[model samples]
Target: METTLHHLHRPLGSTGLNVSPLGLGTVKLGRDQGVKYPNGFRIPDDSQARQLLALARGLGINLIDTAPAYGVSEQRLGPLLQGQRDHWVVVSKVGEEFIDGRSHFDFSPAHTRLSVERSLKRLKTDRIELVLVHSDGRDLEILQHSGVYEALAELKREGKILGYGLSGKTVEGGLLALEHGDCAMVTYNLNEQAERPVLDYAQAHGKGILVKKALASGHVCLKSDEDPVRLSFELLFGHPGVGAAIVGTINPQHLSDNVRTAAAVLSQQQ
Candidate 1:
């Protein structure tokens, strides 16, 4: 029998959103350029993408992460998720766009509002459950000078987004995001724990923390003989504020393995 994660869903802090511990990242579903993965991959076709989504759902994953910076991910998901909108907690991003094989960022309030609106149309959804600012390594500048957070907050008040936050790159940025927003997407894995202070703050303040690159962007298990995936999960769930880990795998077997590893680690925590 296959292990399922439905029983392990947890609250996303005070956002009133419950997400599975493992979220299926859809970057590979739209773009394959300039990614940091160890191995190169071909973008999956519609049939393959649909099967992948079904597989993820079967494994009890409800959180789906995407972004405009991920090429046509939002556009593809709009059509692909035709009838299953409510079944998943869709997380998309603003402030960054992948164009001409490069990344562009706009954190102004006007761009933020436009980006969220465009994402809604692209994803063919009434509202995105959570929208994050796709940071461009200028986390502090963006948070301070840019009115992006205020824009997202307005959208939340308008019911266009349930919650808003930042996919930040620094510990300070992550901490600031949780203070003014509902969650923070930080890089936390076996290899990098630099943003751990942000996780601690979230746990103390009742804010949500979503981990990105949980497996070090496919660079796991270099020094130890232990299972790399399991070690990654152990490090993640051991943290008190980590709500979910977004793993970007297009392969079915890898997805199943990830879910199983996460389930095992979480069960041990219980």
Candidate 2:
């Protein structure tokens, strides 16, 4: 019973990138401080990280999501992903940075350019596939007033990044981002449907929609004989605009189960 999602890869809007339905989020690979998971866990060591990556690839996961705000995630992935860069659709972020257990944000064009460059250096890659603005809950303000999206567009034209968008918190921000960007990462799950309009807009416009917090940030309540992960994926994959779901699980067993559940759910879609 080997699980795989190789054939379940979906298009990421008009960006011309195809990602697995379940993307492996690398926040736990390099940072454990101030996370919102149900329980605390140690960051995986080098060998362990390698095994986790191998498992992910074995399960046919091709999308890897990391961000500078994820502490040393970008830096750690640089060396870990040495020669297999082409195997994964690498996603990195700008605008939000975690420092000394506190989160800070900068949406200036200058900072946005600098952030992408730094991420490139840290990830040891020539170009990143996708670069998203890590919103600090000020979705509309950042998308409207801040020059972050403009800077991302410039980077896209310059070939530093193939596509750009926002990991936004509000529906208005997600809608506006889809208007000008390739993708929009929104919070979608059983607990929150406030951003459903954003997904509707993406579906109508052929824009990409990446779902974040699909399992309620690891706070999903358990019921007798019911699988929360499967339920979450059903809600996500049932939608037309969802390109992928970013699940930040560092545990190997959890990863395997997630891919298996996602594969089963997607199999029903066909």
Q: Top lDDT: which candidate number?
A: 1
TM-score for each candidate, following the candidate numbering? 0.98, 0.98
Inter-residue clash pairs, candidate 1:
none
Candidates' C-alpha lDDT:
0.93, 0.92
Predicted candidate 2 versus true structure: per-residue lDDT over 109-158, tens digit per residue: 99999999999999999999998899998988998899899999999999
Which candidate leads in TM-score? 1
Which portions of model 1 show Cα errors greater than 4 Å? 221-223
Q: Candidate 1 lDDT, tens digit per residue, 1-270?
A: 899999999999989999999999999999999999888999999999999999999999999999999999999999999999999999999999899999988999999999999999999999999999999888988998899998999999999999999999999899889999999999998878999999999999999889999999888846678899998999899988999999999999999999999999899899
Model 2 compared with the native: what TM-score?
0.98
